[model samples]
Target: MSNTPLVQMIGIEKHFGGVRAVDHVSLDLYPGEVVGVLGHNGAGKSCLMRILAGAMLPNEGEIRVGGKTVTFADPNDAREAGIETIYQTLALADHLDAPSNLFLGRELKTRFGNLDDARMLEESRKVLARLNPNFKNLSDPVSSLSGGQRQVIAIARAIYFDTRVLIMDEPTAALGPSETAMVSDLIRQLRSEGIGILLVSHDMHDVFDLCDRVVVMNKGRLVGAHGIDEVTKDDVLSLIVKGELPADWSARNLEAAQ
Candidate 1:
């Protein structure tokens, strides 16, 4: 594996009318590492990730994957580049079964041009078994599944497509404790598989427990980046609320300031 990051968003900027939603934000994610993005509601973390996911374009910035600069014209371009985003909605068809939902737009077909249901189901089983061993209701409509099960399906779909960079937005927002733990375990599994993850979440517990690093933003500006061992929950909250670097982070920059 090379030292280059799996994905890099440099100097990203997004403006809406008179407001700069994201200003000169830069982030890097590496394989097998989960970097949690934290910010208040309007702090601009979502805007930056959206640009990286190809959901929205930035006014100024460049995205590089595998050390090659590329421009994403749309989400399809991002997916083709091995980037998969699992939004909070999960984006599944309620009436469809697991296999049908997994192969929603990109269905596999047989030589005769018919849908390859057997192959699709087999692949779905393999992926789901790896992600969620308890997910035995593959033939049931997603509407009948629990919140955690649905999340497993969403994640299984992403990994099934050979996803390299996975962006998960508020994955456990609506889950109970057990479901949250289930999703957290799946995230750890994905990280162990050498997938680069950009996790956007407001849950401090999730960030502290799951991420290797935390990147904070405030009012469209990058506040600071801290390794998991470098900051505490209070330190992160201070940064998010007041845009202040942690005391230790400030200490590291004292000589540079002088």
Candidate 2:
């Protein structure tokens, strides 16, 4: 991972009328690293990520990409800024084939001004090969594919362009063990390629296994951040359940400050 943050959300706050969905949260994602964002339901983790992904607007905050401030009016704005988000839904066109879904909004055009099936399929093949070599159902509708195959389609779409930062929400949520392993391997591959990743997952084991660091949130506030090697599963669970960092974690943070 690079020393400079690929994306930074500082002092982010959001509210729905009288309810505070997010509150003064800050996070940093660095190149070639996966940072897991963990929190219980209604803890504002989704709201924070939505703001980062440009699906929702933050009431107060500054977002910096490559150390320069940026604003996301909508999801398209975020995408154009090289930020891609793969939600839990995968947001795929189930009736369409893998190649069609990969180029749903941004299809290639031939010289005569027609949908270029050959070009799309060829490009899809390249992206899919890099992400999932075992995927061979190019012509089959995504609905006919398995959970992991569908995920590969979504991820391929996000990464087809100049993707700098990727946000994955519960990537392995609906997958079986084998499918989950595939997604895990894909995540590592993307990280190795220098794509900053923010992984939003409720699965403790997934976060511990795949993330270089973890950020815990509670009641819309950031409770703590921990290195994977420095904190145990129990330490993270305590923060999620109680919004309190373990004593050892606190001591470590204090010592680092000193």
Candidate 3:
């Protein structure tokens, strides 16, 4: 509920041997805002987010949460700082049940210092019900659920843990229209709950529909970031395809209008 940015990356630079994976990329995300990252393959969008989520270390640059600098050596560090990344493959254990998956690494402990099945189940049910009422039983395996249901579980897990920021990668990739709409509504619900989100998606429709701002990246460099009200789908396409703002895409117009 702070008015300050939930997360910010300034002049982030990362390299792999001789290759520069991230080049002077900068971004700021505010609480309850959904910032969409758009780029072609190899544009460094994923690499930059990986660094933010603490899945990978950056060669240079600084990350700040609520205006304080942080050094995250691992994803756990980011999680401890209230950041969550929902990847495409969803780091979920398909063999595990809903409650087990919800409390995977950080299990609720009982009074006797063992796994607290009741606490975990109760918490999981409450969170899931708030997010998705159809989350019938906590004993169901994820592999048996639909793609949207599985994603709902992952999102519910993050929300239950009080994560202030979420970085979702291609969340609607394999979902049907109805499923995508459900996820979209859930995203809005999270925003209303005061959680910031960094959404990475190739789907222009999703980006244009759900995001407040759109960031464009190309060849490991940030081309630009614009408010959704300022640009159209055509403008976003131009940025992604040309690696530069098109002549017709007036950033100044977008900026002033926005």
Task: Assess each prediction's global lDDT (C-alpha) against the native.
Answer: 0.88, 0.90, 0.88
Q: Evaluate model 1: give its lDDT.
A: 0.88
Candidate 1 residue pairs that clash: none
lDDT score for residue 8 of model 2: 91
* Residue-level lDDT tens digits of model 3 in 29-116: 9988999999998999999989998999998899999999999999889999999988877778998998999898889997789999
Model 3, residue 98: what's the lDDT? 89
Q: To one decimal, what is the Cα RMSD in angstroms of model 2 from the true structure?
A: 2.3
lDDT of 1 at 19: 100
lDDT tens digits by residue: candidate 2, 1-258: 668999999999999998888989989999999999999989999899889989999999999999999999989889988899898899998899999999987789999989999999999999999877798999998999988789889988988989989999998888888878878998898899999999999999899999999999999899988788878899999999999977687687677678
Regions of model 2 farther than 4 Å from truth? 251-258
TM-score of each: 0.90, 0.91, 0.92
Q: Which run of 10 residues does model 3 get worst, by summed lDDT?
A: 248-257
Which model, 2 or 3, shows the larger lDDT? 2
How many clashes does each candidate structure show, in the order listed? 0, 0, 0
Q: Return whichever of 1 and 2 wins on lDDT.
A: 2
